[model samples]
Target: MDIESLAPVVDSILEAAETRGGGGDRLSVSPHSFPDAVEAAAADGRVPVIAEIKPTSPTTTGERTEDSVVLAEQMVEGGATALSVLTEPSHFGGSPEALDRVREAVEVPVLRKDFILREEQLDTVAADMVLLIARFLNDLDRMVDAARERGFQVLVETHTATEVEAAIEAGADIVGVNNRDLTKLEVDLETFEEVAPTVPEDVLLVAESGIGSQRDVERMQAAGADALLVGSAIMDGDVTANTRRLVTTEGHDT
Candidate 1:
């Protein structure tokens, strides 16, 4: 990834921070419990799915026609354990307002899925969980601390084995192995399977991207993933049915 591709998102977040006086007091906090919600979703011994609310993507041209809030409600009704809302504006066609709308419409914990770089950005958004991409941060530990201070659980996203190690070194409680390589915009399921074992058992492992079917969900679970973060596929069709299919898919015998 050029890394610079995220400059617009960062600029917008920083601008919001400046406008808000660089404090979290102005942000509306979500009451839903993220970790607890994930736990309950996984209680059935099936991998819980975090259905995402994304209208568009830089990698693809087709955008979902449904309203984000309505889609969030449908996903929740379809048995989604948690929700992820895209907050990046330029490429993903997302905004903090979209996240806020979804958070208000659903009871599940909502994750602010954006190219988070600074503490100010974390403070500016209201969500139960925050995403910290390992490769994008100049100071991973500092940003992680910032997220924690705001009472948000961090989902440290990694694309490689080295990034996974860095996430673990930063004491990340949830490690998301992104199957899609951000730089190339390519989806490879094997990436998660190859790096999952390196994560400690105590830390939760999440497989993000390229999960298109029940077999795909099962494969990730078999590779030691505790959860799945599915977006594009769910947004492309009936949100409720898509989420139900992924969540209800049975994995191999443990």
Candidate 2:
């Protein structure tokens, strides 16, 4: 998505940051590691699924009103390796408190999923990992460094091959390819498949967005995705069952 389309959202986040005074004094260090969880799951011969706690999204049909902590616990029961909690309040219907609740309720590493524009925003993030969009930031490397300094692992997100290169050049240890083209709000599974080959083998690869079923999970695995970050699909109906289906889906060996 053009960063301009999210101007209002970014502005709101900045306003909130200013109110919070940009410090992590209230936050405690997370003992969990996001990439380690993914690697452990893959080593155990299961699909590494980073199930998301998304209440609503601009592209979804409706909102989920379930308790965020409850959803997070259920996802862990269903074999989710890690959890991605949306903290973008305006369009995504999420809040930082929800992320904190989920993090406390589950043992898995929690990823802060939001349109993070400024490094100051990272100061109060309690999540174990953070999502930084390669296409959104003018200096991905600086943001990555800032996140690392805060002791949070980074998942650099990209939508194309060029962005994938930018992520690597920015020193991203884990890279996620999002299938949805933010500008059009349209999704195509081929987006990840097309970009997967361009990612180096040593760097962890995560397939994000547009994954809704066992078949879709398999397709991503076959295309060399080390992990799958699923959102709306699992949040639509039964969180536990939906997460179970995707995590247990049979797929080619990575």
Alpha-carbon local distance difference test for all models? 0.81, 0.84
Q: Write the per-residue lDDT of candidate 1 for residues 63-162, one digit (tens) a residue.
A: 8867889989999888888999998776677888888888878788899998765667776668889899898776898888778777788899998889
lDDT of 2 by residue, 109-215 (tens): 89999877778778755889999999778889999998888788899999999999999999998999999876666799999999999999999999999998888
C-alpha positional error of residue 27 in candidate 2 after TM-score superposition, expressed in Å: 6.3
Question: Which TM-score value belongs to model 1?
Answer: 0.87
After TM-score superposition, the amount by which residue 135's alpha carbon in candidate 1 deviates from its true location, in angstroms, is 0.3
Model 2 residue runs over 4 Å out of place are 1-28, 250-254
lDDT at 128, model 2: 90
Return the clash pairs for model 2, or none.
none
Candidate 2, which ten residues in sequence have the lowest lDDT sum? Answer: 17-26
Runs of candidate 1 with Cα error greater than 4 angstroms are 1-31, 250-254
